[model samples]
Target chain A: MTSRVIFPHKVLPYLLLVPQIAITLVFFYWPASQALRQSTLREDPFGLVTTFVGLGNFRQVLSDPDYIGSVQTTIIFSAATALIPMAIALVLAVMADKVIKGRGFYRTLMIWPYAVAPAIAGMLWLFLFNPTIGTFAYMLRRAGYDWDPLLNGNQAMLMIIMAAAWKQISYNFLFFVAGLQAIPKSLLEAAAVDGAREVKRFWTIVFPLLAPTSFFLLVVNTVYAFFDTFGIIHAVTSGGPGKATETLVYKVYNDGFVNLMLGSSAAQSVILMGIVIALTAIQFRYVERKVHYA
Target chain B: MPERTEAGTTSRSRRSPWVSHAVLIAGILIVVFPIYYTFVASTLSLQQILRPPLQLLPGSHFLDNYYEALFGGLGRVGGINVWTLLLNTSIVALSVAVGKIVISILSAYAIVFFRFPFRMTFFWVIFITLMLPVEVRILPTYKVMVDLGLIDTYTGLTLPLMASATATLLFRQFFMTIPGELLEAARVDGAGPWRFFFDFVLPLSKTNIAALFVILFIYGWTQYLWPLLVTNSNDMNTIIIALRKMISYADADTQWHLVMVTTIFAILPPVAVVVLMQRWFVKGLVETEK
Candidate 1:
């Protein structure tokens, strides 16, 4: 994959690779291997002894009802976070693309939320929806709806979902805009000449053509919801209201750091790693084909 | 052909463009409402915030609230002022951005420019790290940090997160596009690897480097979970982490006005970078993923 003519350095190449390789091994590989090793080992109460229990931790974790609940929570959270913003973004992107004027203006105004930290975004929503003090909460109460995320599990999940989805709309909007632009105007024009209406043409032609981008975004958003929304969960609910908001990642942290269940946490870590591997593999398989779309 | 089709469509549908504009305007309002509400709340007095249906417009207490947040009016978080948190975040961001770029560029160059043994092995080693994000390896990674005595240190904050496989992959992809003639020409001029790297490669990669820096800086600035775990002291907290500490969910005495002010301060820098360097930010995001 390199050039035909290149440097013939032996030591310099290794020297150049040292920093990245070192950091990767120490921080990435070592910890990962440790997770694997620790998954099978259980420590005593006093932290003095580690007895090897092959597959015991994984068996216990899989059987635990709380772990199962967390798995369901992750599934619902990821699905909602992925779909809600994407649907909204597609609508906004189509409208932005259709508008003849202020296209760039709308894009500018809309995209800065991508830059907001998930935690900060969570804070904004929490403040606005704070039951006792929130402006929106006050209005909702006036409108005769019960409003309190702090006490209600379903409401808390909704709050984090809204915050996470809100932050991600800008990213999805950008990609959808790019995807729409990549479709050939000639195709739509051809459909028009054949007596197809605009909305019908979009459904039959444009929507099908955006399949690649849509599929790619599905994978990306899943990963984002899976890993990147840690801040939002931590800040907004801390997996509260009876662990309704704890995703797999949050559970791993809580079990490991907060609850001090080393073996169980390590097992959960290994499970998460498997999930990432599967998701990443799916992404690469799709993206490999989509690479030449340009 | 396309122009005629456009005219045909226009005649078939005399729908007002105002509808599209109105829809987009509504979308923008919803998207921007929370941010604007935060800013307005930051300027109000405690009484104003405590009362429901506070005025939509900003109150007259902007300077007082901000002054209180910035100074030690409310007892400083971890004895560190807002400025300290801001400074710590900036340092982490700049270091992570610069460090990832430098190391990734060098590794990419090494892989692309020279025929070294075990090259693919090393590449795969780095590639595998992508599957092992810090979230999945939280306990073990913290153990490693604790063992290495890097906890509560800047190195702990920045170093573990800097092994960027995506960045290296991007640089490698870009380097593969470099014209072979340039390297041949540099070789003819008797340029060493270092010389070619400094003179030719560095200059040629300026745009890519700039784009990557913008994306990575935001990534660094917005980090929460890692910093939350590694840094225990109040002074060591980044703004994102510090903001969490500032809010007391259970207490009636939580400083609502100051929390709002701190939220604005926490959001401004990265958002400013995104808006200011919009072109490169978009390009960097699109290119890196591919």
Candidate 2:
């Protein structure tokens, strides 16, 4: 009787977590474990018996030039996407902050791009960049400069980066606005009294205070650019005229779903997961220290 | 001296009302122009769209383009029905939103208000999952869905995403701000945990719940990748995927008009939701971040 009473008192709190645990196990852990298992095996179509390939699949995926190129593309894409949006967002936020009027209007307008779905965003841009009928293409032709993202690697990469950055600017703006708002008004007043100019005040006082928000956005944006761009890439270019836009996640989706290389795809997924985890851990450990809580 | 200077500075800093309106109007134009362009493009003919300098105004071909895009036509592989896609997308989004909110509230209540062993560890585990991208886990998730016989079903699209670690974390942080005395008082009044949760806690959390609802609804509605992977039939496909299929079909001959029409149709619902629920969405972000 005593044990029963104690059990209800003690375990009731933990019991509430049961739903979350169950869902995560089924959706997250089970699939993750299955992926790990599949990564180690060589399974053919028709669900036939699979042989243990050990590290063979990993070696093949890693050594292939296409996969190596994808890694390079992933790194460049992630870095550019993360850094560019952040820089643009920071500038916009500062400008918006300095403006004496229409703060709410600016905030709302700036965040508008985030509302559009990624696939639609890609389609929208694709229409704008269409070779035969595109507005931008027509304008370029008028200017005597031939423009076709479909034909050039550099242009394709630029298109992906621009599209990703455009969608992400709103998110970055939101966070930056929130971060800017969190700065105590008294500090700004004090800096103004100290004869610090607007730019100087921002660089020294405001920027340091916004570090935590920046760091958080950096990690989130990197992951987003790394993994979330798959849908856009799939919709817009399908990795393009010469596989110029194929990032790691895109390759995984292509191999697993389109190419029907389930085992090899699983191996690629594992490698992708490892790289992301390592990058995230390193960012959290190193960059997080610079964040000013106050 | 400081007081006088501060008052003078405040007076100097205040901008004229006209200036504020001008800034707001300019900002609004920049933001709304692309969407306006989309609507205009949707109304024009293919030839008009291809014309140099582009048509800045809406054309008379809106109905025809929309009709052809929605129903298959010459040079179009159109099998999509927009209404059906919208219904499917809404069903999936609503279920995920409701499921995620309920689960998150319960999990957060347990973690924040009660004394439980391994609580910190559990929280860490939940946080860790946030770092693990869905891309890495998609294959395994697909296999599990297949095993459960969920393929091409609404349940398959909704179930895996129904429980979000981010929501749980947000709720946990929100719950922590509530006073312990409220819970203790309810307990002293002979209220059990469930009764206390329903009677005392939930009513106070309406704003947070609403905010979470908007965010989750938008996230779920706009979800493309997983749904695209799982659903095979046009009947089962959501609006975003349907948009993608339409665009790909229009790729070769490049029917800009039809593509624009379908794109506008695809974007309308989510944009409506966002504009309508903007207050709650912004509120939720501010509250959770705090």
| Best prediction by DockQ | 1
Compared with the true structure, what per-residue lDDT tens digits does model 1 show for residues A95-213? 87677678878988898788899999999998899897788999999999998898889999999999999998998888888888778777877787898887898799878888887
By TM-score, the best candidate is: 1
> Could you tell me the TM-score of candidate 1?
0.97
Those runs of model 2 whose alpha carbons end farther than 4 Å from true positions after fitting are A1-15, A44-49, A279-292, B1-32, B62-78, B114-125, B251-255, B286-290
Report lDDT per candidate: 0.88, 0.76
DockQ of 1: 0.65
Judged by DockQ cut-offs, the docking class of candidate 1 is medium
Residue-by-residue lDDT tens digits, candidate 2, B122-192: 88777677656679877778878888998899888987787677788778766766776776677778888
Q: Give TM-score, chain B, model 1.
A: 0.93
